[model samples]
Target chain A: MDLTVKIRNKTLPNPVGVASGTFGYGEEYAQLTDLSALGALYTKALTVEPRPGNALPRLVETPAGMINSIGLANVGVERFLTEKIPYLETLTCPVILNVAGSTEEEYASVISRVDSQNAIWAYEVNISCPNVKHGGMAFGTDPVQVERLTKTLRKLTDKAIIMKLTPNVTDIALIAQAAEAGGADAISCINTVMGMVVDINSRKPAIPAISGGLSGPAIRPVGVAAVWRVSRVVTIPVIGLGGILTWEDAVQYLLAGADAIQIGTGNFVTPDASVKVLNGIISYMKEAGFQKIEDFHGHF
Target chain B: MKNFGSSILNQKEIAIGYREMTISWPQSLEAPLPGQFLTVKVTENPAPLLRRPFALSGFDREKNTASLIYQLRGPATRLMATLEINSSIEVLSPLGNNFTLPEKDETPLLVAGGIGLGPVLYLARELDKNGFSPRLVVGGRTESFLPDLSNLKNGSIHYCSDDGSAGFRGTAVDYLKSLDWKELPSARLYSCGPQGMLNACHNLALEKNIPSEVSMEQMMACGVGACMGCAIEVIGPEQYARVCKEGPVFDSRRIKWT
Candidate 1:
């Protein structure tokens, strides 16, 4: 089994990547985990401008999941390039910049800027942002839009472009196909699924934002299923996500045909979750008659 | 995530049957400030996908222990109240930002309600250790529901109960009317607790022109800033900031509390 994978022509030491949003810029939780151990790091979604985010009670616990609508509050692009990007350059793994935009112009602006700088390993295009009332059901929902965005980036820069898809879409396979046709080098399936949690007593929403994206273990099955379904449809590799907590869980995605796995909600509960998951994968491989982590990718 | 299986540290009942647990983890306790919090993995089996967020009441750097206070509110926190000491817990900590304390020689005033006293106590001690003594004003619904956090520090403690069960009856707010506002003419106010209490403190601080900072408690996913899970509106100015990131602590005036 070979756990190593090459995406956008870049070689990853392993098949595990820390899911975006869970590990905020990675700089916030450095003391809690070994940042270098993970195969790669995905930053929090960076919008074209600085945002203050939504209002209070942004989180609500469901029976087996969590709902959030962070409204993509970020330090904007300029601040990220100067302050965050420089710090990101020091990390051992390549940093995948998760870019969100309301318009193609904004997206193009972010790409050209980040592309100009050589710090980032690749660009992770976010099409699943639910909090914003955007240009349509978001750029990723419509397959044509996804293809156009991918093709646009394909023309803009030589860096590997990974289109992040929202699970709420009607057909993830169609979306993935469109991305591939548009020249996307890879696809990371299942950005947060849209969700809402209301306070029964107050008859109001829990989050300051009326609604938010759902993440954590409850969404794992949904995410993995999408990855499996889409991986079967697209020739390009898939970076699986949604509720990945341990190494054993990550291996399931590999067996389901994911070239890589992103640990999202786990980072919130345990910062070193990526390290633990990676180690667990290595140990499981040795015990399960597998030689490498990559060998398990798509065996199912 | 290091789950110790069953080594629960300290559990004590406060306010009805609600109990608070202080768990031990090997992780460093560096980032958390006075008002910041942590997300503790609840349940021997996690029924909830997210860990419950708790205020970092205090921590022992020498022992690598993080203390959390909570009432037995639901199925999850109820599970947390049932842990035994020495049980190893899987946790992520030093999680959020802390409250800002007054400089040395300044007398601080801390206002708290129910379990809200947790973070304020840590702030009080941080101030005390640095040679500034803060006056403690605590409140609760009834004497029985009040917590017995008697060991926090040697600061002058004032108590108020809604049902007249203890101290100056009729709410912590009522006692405020009788205090010598001039004696502490130049004081920085620190507060935590229920929203009504916080609002009252905010109003009073503004009326008195006293500088104030507050700890905002909200249900959160990722006690860090990423999930956008714990943002509170800084009311008057109309901006939303994460209770976990921009703060578990905000200058009282900055909070857009309606």
Candidate 2:
């Protein structure tokens, strides 16, 4: 009946977390739903400097998904420590600071600046964002660069480090192994899949950037498969995410070997999506006679 | 803002392509003001994955009800059209900033086009109830494209059609230009419509030195402003502001019209 998930020295209260960038610094959704119900609250991506992000028409709807090119719009690390931390400190759930940058030095500097805050529970290294022109998918696609960045950031903080991986690679397991080799505590797999939608009359891309990261129920299979592949290659816990809209979708990831699951695009669909997911998972475990989160893994 | 479920009290088609849906509003929640919006989870189906946002067209404080006027366009709205009365739906409401009231000395000139008539009508009605003589000019492709306005009273309502089949023979901006500025020297503009009409209104306001505000539309996700998906370019250091957060309503001067 226990739902606690442990990653290295840290312990997540449950297995359900709202994905980074989906939950904005814990302040936006505070009025809508209960925050303490989450096992972890992953903040929006924090970079070395504030980003204005992409231009207008940043989002467009597809059949069962939406494409976005937000380009890591954030208030930067200094604002994260000063403006965001005061509110994050009031939350009961573990706050995983999602860090992203264009270079290794920028990533290291961000971690060094905010690493001292006790309110931050862990660091979710974002190396797989597809919307950016630099650093994001570039560092993620190459295993050598992934290993180097992970190792460098590992030395900066004693907190748990979760390497987020992109699905737009030839062999995702290889990248997971590189992260494990570089001393990552855990790995969150399958960032948004690269996708595009075109306007037939205008003969132009629906979004201004021409291409964006596709998320929602459409990318669920890709994420589950990525979790299955990456979980087999790396010994560390695999936190699965992508198009988890319901609790049943989360169970699919747990059965596929994801130690924990994150609700990303589903948050926009239902504000209390994570809470529903967590409650559903608990009911499922009880009905299946499973005691802990690991019991839902490897049963397939 | 709060996320709660409400039963559909009524749903009826008021025009060829548009329908007005009235739902029971919770008395505990603050009453929605003009230009403020709500996002509706259209269906449990995954095809329309995200909630669709709509502005509050009308609110009956005595009855504890709020209504939205939506066009029967796209898969989400098309699905919404099929919803029967008494059907339960999830709603996240009173989101974004509301339209600010004009100064007592200023005349409110409200303009609407196409499906944008909802908030403008709401604003005009609220202004009228508050003892201001608001002038509402509605424009569409033809008379059929506009919603039925027989229920809206206490305000001066003008209708314009492209083919001159309704009231005036031009766009809403054309009607605005046709007004004698010297008569209503303190006229302030508030508009919601197509980009072309909004831009034209912005230009007219600039030319006449009239203060103006506009309701902007963009494809949105997480209407609570978490996703930063509904971005509108503006003249500022930040460059972009979320249409769902900073506005669905903003001063006309703030927008960087192309």
Candidate 3:
């Protein structure tokens, strides 16, 4: 089954990639499933410093999904560079580093620190995070800042740069345009949308942080709509995510014009979620007699 | 410890071959231990994305199946309730660690609160099956919510309720408070349930000097060890330990209780 997807100069073996923040360094899920089978692996968003993250109740379960405010907790770039990057070198599939920061300098600092690593195939700029009280919304919603941050990442490294945009925006296409103008190689759209759940019994928030990002099957359609719109407007390839659980779900994204699809909430449910989707996509290609994953992109 | 391929096994009502739906490796699952829980990924919805974590009630030796018992808490739980017999529930487990079982001669009194039964029933059966006589204390708001305890045939079963609707009318703590600790002061104790109930038991156990273990429940992310999402400030030197790694179960004396 033909399942190759070309983003910039890189050739992905399949259209199924692990969405940022879901796989957590690609090694954690290694104990449960095959990581190499995925088209690519997206690491959790790493900041410049190790984060303890939000307090208790960082997550909550809704009808068909869960809301999380993990606050992009990571071991920071220095440690990730020293510890994570070395481990990543062992994997054959392309590992995309997700970088997030409160300030422009911090983002640049983390990028510069990992800029020399030849192992990394691309960098996903996490301009969206809702749990942090500061800077979470600064770069995500504004078109100009999205452009500025995307350009900054572009200048920092020759490694392919994919700007991740938040769905918590009035104009998602506008942000995608900014990333393109800033020279982003590709764009991964629709990060978690901001939402809050309150525990009616205690008169308190369900998630201890008062609010968090909503994800799961509930967010898939919204993600699909955003990716569909953005992919239509942008010339760069689009990596889509939200509530992608099955092979059919990935097809929806690709058909919605996403060049590739990332498995996010699905990963939390099943660690080998990426593998299932990838295999399913391949199986579908064989059954349908498609020559390539891209051959079916955006027709639906 | 082995990385099983990814795919969610649906939830279920019962397991066929085993008397009780004892999910085992190739049957239920491999990794999840007693205290460790597996996140049940519910794909039917999308707004909330993370899989819900449930303590393993038993171990599955078969790679093809996993066994779990859950109440109709919400959509996720409701979805799990309709699971067919022998149908696999997508699970990640043998998680956390089994409550440290006492030695051959050691007697442990098992106290389970409400649905807290989900995480402690296996331990109770293990002790009973091993000939380690343990008295089972099961508590619930009303007798109607009580899970079937006939599987625990080797032990004595006691029921407690808040409104005097059952065996002891008062709360489980009330029954516990009134119990004759003198007879079993030397017995090891294991308790799991709501924080309030556990705290009451914790104090009573300490006041009576009966060593006890309590399983602490908290929201989690990675379930393995990373993300630090399930940390508790009741154990280790720094007053913090991971529920997923260090324990969903802890020695009552070692925890801060809050």
Candidate 4:
């Protein structure tokens, strides 16, 4: 079975990749698994300025998932290009830089700085950061804003641009269509369902940010539904993510019409979760007498 | 840092609800620093999902044995307390940064609160091996809650209890405030305990202008840096640093105690 996937002119060796924010530049996991075995690596959210992030009590475990209000803390663009990119360049797989900003110009500026790097194959524009107060969901929830930001970014970088959409919207398909119209190369759906946990004893929110993005097994169905709905309206490749823990979970996203899958919270539980998911997909394909991911793409 | 599946060498309760578990690990697993920790997989099941992180209390270089002292506070720890001898547990170890050691002429003053003694006790032992006699102040809710410190050689321990069931009639912080800096000049302070205790010690250290280090605790998902889960804010510059990565240990001045 073949596993190659094309996003613009770039060809991913497989359909599995580690999600942004969950994997820290893909440098830490190299010791646990072979970096070349997976399809792609999406780094953490990159802002124009170094972010200190949010206050304490940033993480809390729930029923079958986790909530985080990390607030996009990162080394910023300058240090990322200097200190981090050298290690990321050594890997054989494609690296997609996940960029976030508090403003449209901030996004454009970060994209402009990274557009020349050979190590980065694509740019995942993050318009849906729930932890921050502005610029993230503000730009993502509205279809017009989504189109405008993508259009502006499309003019700046020659690299493939993938619009990451938030799941908190009333209608996700409309937003996906807007991104496609704005000249986006692909679309990655469902950047964490917005949710929060309360500490009953303290009578306060579990996270200091009061609310956070929920990711893990509990949100799998929501992610599949969003991907299924968005893929129906957009012609661009849909990268599905959210609550993917096992090989079976990855297959569900593919059957729902996601051309590729990104593993997020699963990496925290098991360091080599993406590799395991990739192997599981290949095994299932062989068993079902199917050859390549295309045979089962959107089969549902 | 490395992840190893180490077998339980022996385990027994040292306090009312605390257990001291020693696990036999491969020789390749390097010695963990005093303030470093390990993320433990309490059970074979994934229900709890995240591994429970514990401070490295002790280790034996020749025997290739490492030890962890933890209290039965949550479901994960409850399950961890019931593990039989010889049962193998997955341990991701030598994580986070360690406490900075003081100079030969500087005095080491170690403070611990309740089960927070985990790292403090280890630091005391380490200082002892280096020919420095550290002064350890241990406090708990009651005498029964305090772990035995007889095994900590080459150091002096002052026990304090809330109900005056042990050495002093007040908290560790109160005991710290009672000390006269004039008598013990150039003493470097190292502390780990409840947030209240750590905060009190931080303020006292600031007032006395004694260089201090604190080991902070928070709920963590991945013991590694990837999750960005265990976050704490710093003073002056005011930014967040992951407790799992930047530290479970930091300069007392770096932490915004509030």
User: What clash pairs does model 4 have?
Assistant: A216-A243
1 or 2, which is superior by TM-score? 2
DockQ per candidate, 2 decimals: 0.55, 0.86, 0.37, 0.54
Compute the lDDT for candidate 4: 0.87
**Isolated chain B TM-score per model:** 0.89, 0.98, 0.83, 0.97
Model 4 TM-score relative to the real fold: 0.94
Report the candidate with higher TM-score, 1 versus 4. Answer: 4
Ranking by DockQ: 2, 1, 4, 3
- Candidate 2 error regions (>4 Å): B151-153
The alpha-carbon lDDT assigned to residue B224 of candidate 1 equals: 63
Per-residue C-alpha lDDT of model 2 across residues A1-300, encoded as one tens digit per residue: 789999989789999999988889878999887899999999999999999998778988888999989999999877777898999999999999999999999999999999888899999999999998884799999999999999999999999999999999999999999999999999998899999999999999887799999999999999999999998888899999989999999999999999999999999999999889999999999999999989987766
Q: Model 4: residues >4 Å from true position, as ranges? A: B43-46, B177-183, B236-238
Clashes of each: 32, 0, 49, 1
The digit string of per-residue lDDT tens for model 4 on A1-300 reads 679888888788999999998888887676666778879898998999988778778888876788888889889999998999999888889999999998999999999998888999999999999999984799999999999999999999889999999999999999999999999999998898888898899999988789899888889899999999998998889999998888999999998998899999888777778888999999998998878777776455
TM-score of 2: 0.99
Best by DockQ: 2
Of all true interface contacts, what fraction is found in model 4? 0.51
| Residue range B132-219, candidate 4, lDDT tens digits | 8898999999999987767556668988999999999899889878887788888889999998988888888888898999999988
CA lDDT for candidate 1: 0.77
Error of 1 at A220 (Å): 1.5
